[model samples]
Target chain A: QQPVQSPQAVILREGEDAVINCSSSKALYSVHWYRQKHGEAPVFLMILLKGGEQKGHEKISASFNEKKQQSSLYLTASQLSYSGTYFCGTELIFGNEKLTFGTGTRLTIIP
Target chain B: DAGVTQSPTHLIKTRGQQVTLRCSPKSGHDTVSWYQQALGQGPQFIFQYYEEEERQRGNFPDRFSGHQFPNYSSELNVNALLLGDSALYLCASSRQQISGNTIYFGEGSWLTVV
Candidate 1:
């Protein structure tokens, strides 16, 4: 089954902060964060492997829960360039690299 | 490197027609995976090819098929397409590994079925 993402969409002003959450009923091996602009493929943001793992890039960071079935992406000091949809992909700890992505969170950063 | 490259960036076809989208994996990569994304949803995995063979598949129908060439390039073929088949077709490439690995994607082929 696909993972569930909270807050279908968010609108923010430049430098504001936002959090997007993803949860899966099944166990997850890894949680991958990606951002996709309009009419473009998703770009890798960061990946959290072990439980309680937290990773960051620039002002963006994400945390995987202790159960390994949940993740949250934190966007801080957001810029207008952050306008896009964010997706969290879940991977099995032991299997092929096929990823199941969440519904996605649409973030619009206004200047 | 060129990352990943796809052909026929945009195309329109009828409901009963067929279409072929191509992709070339990045250098030093031997695995290719295809995904389908609708207007607002996240990408849905279709299949993955490795060593010129289909090693894994998603819940997609048989009408959705693909092949990997000797040069590590791949083609996604949809036969007897339906209106619901209209979506952005994405091709991703990554190196094969025992555990999960990062995959890079092409720009994607946008398909419109009329």
Candidate 2:
């Protein structure tokens, strides 16, 4: 099943912050975060495994909550370059190599 | 290192026709996965190939098939296509067994079914 993402859209000014959330009904073995600019392919950001851990990339950090079947992506001090669509791909527990993606959250950063 | 590469940046086809898209995995990567992305929607998994065999597949129908060569390059073939199949087809590559490994995606092949 496809994952659910909160806040279909968000706008932030430079130096501001925003958060995107992804939730799935099924247990996830991993959560992969990616960003896609208009007319471009999605770029990998980070992957959070099933242990409910967190990882950071520059000012962007993500946390995985295994028990909650959710993951949250935090963009701190957002920059204009951060304007793009963010997606979370969920890997299920059954060894299905396919990753189910969330609808996505569109983020715009203004200077 | 070269990342995933896809062919035919854009293509147009008639309904009921067949189409084949190609992909070359990232350097040293042995697994390739195919995805379909409709406009304004996230990508949906089609299938995955590893070691020249299909290891996993999504809910896609039999009309959607794929093959991975010994060199780890892959091809996605769609037979009896429908207008609904008109979308951006993405190819992602990663190392086999590298759980949680970041899958690298290609620019994608945009297909327009008429």
Candidate 3:
């Protein structure tokens, strides 16, 4: 099943912060976050395993809550470079190589 | 190391025709998956292949098929395409693991079905 993302779109000024949430009904073993600029492929940001797992890349960080079947991506001190579509992919327990992605949240960071 | 690479950056096909898209996985990657992204939507998983055999698939119809070569490269073939088949086909590769590792995606092949 496709995950659900909140705040379909958002705009923020530089140095601001934003959070994107992804929730799935199925139990997730891992959650992957990625950002895609216009006309470009999605770039891997960070992967959050089950509970108690967190990963950060630069100003991007994410956490996975196994009990909630949800993940949240935190963008701290957002930069103009952060403007893009953010997607969260979830890995299910069935061991399928497929990663069901969320509808995506369009983020715009103004300079 | 080179990341995932896809071929035929853009393709145009008429309804009822067949089309094939290719992908080369990143170095040391042993698994390949295919996805379809409609305009303004996130990618939807099509299927995945490992060890030259299909291991898993999404809810996509059987018309969407794929193959993985010994080198870990893969191909997505769509038969009897419909106008709705027009979309960006993305190929992603990852390491086969029980934990489900992060998959790297290619730029994607834009297919237009007239």
Q: Report lDDT (Cα) of residue A39, candidate 3.
A: 77
Mind listing the fnat for each candidate? 0.65, 0.80, 0.70
| Most lDDT-accurate candidate | 2
Per-residue CA lDDT of candidate 2, range B1-114, in tens?
A: 888999989999999999999999899888899999999999999999988999988889999999999999999999999999999999999873545666889999999999
RMSD of each: 1.5, 1.4, 1.4
lDDT of 3 by residue, B1-114 (tens): 999999999999999999999999999999999989998999998889999999888888989988989899999999999999999999999986655587899999999999
Q: How do the candidates score on chain B by TM-score?
A: 0.96, 0.96, 0.95
Model 3's CAPRI class?
medium
* Alpha carbon deviation, residue A66, candidate 2 (Å): 1.5
Please identify model 3 stretches exceeding 4 Å from their true place: B97-100
As a whole number from 0 to 100, the lDDT of residue A7 in candidate 2 is: 93
| Candidate 2 chain A lowest-lDDT run of ten | A91-100
Cα deviation of B21, candidate 2, in Å: 0.4
Give TM per candidate.
0.95, 0.95, 0.96
Sort by DockQ, top down from the best: 2, 3, 1
User: Positional deviation of B10 in candidate 1, in angstroms?
Assistant: 0.3
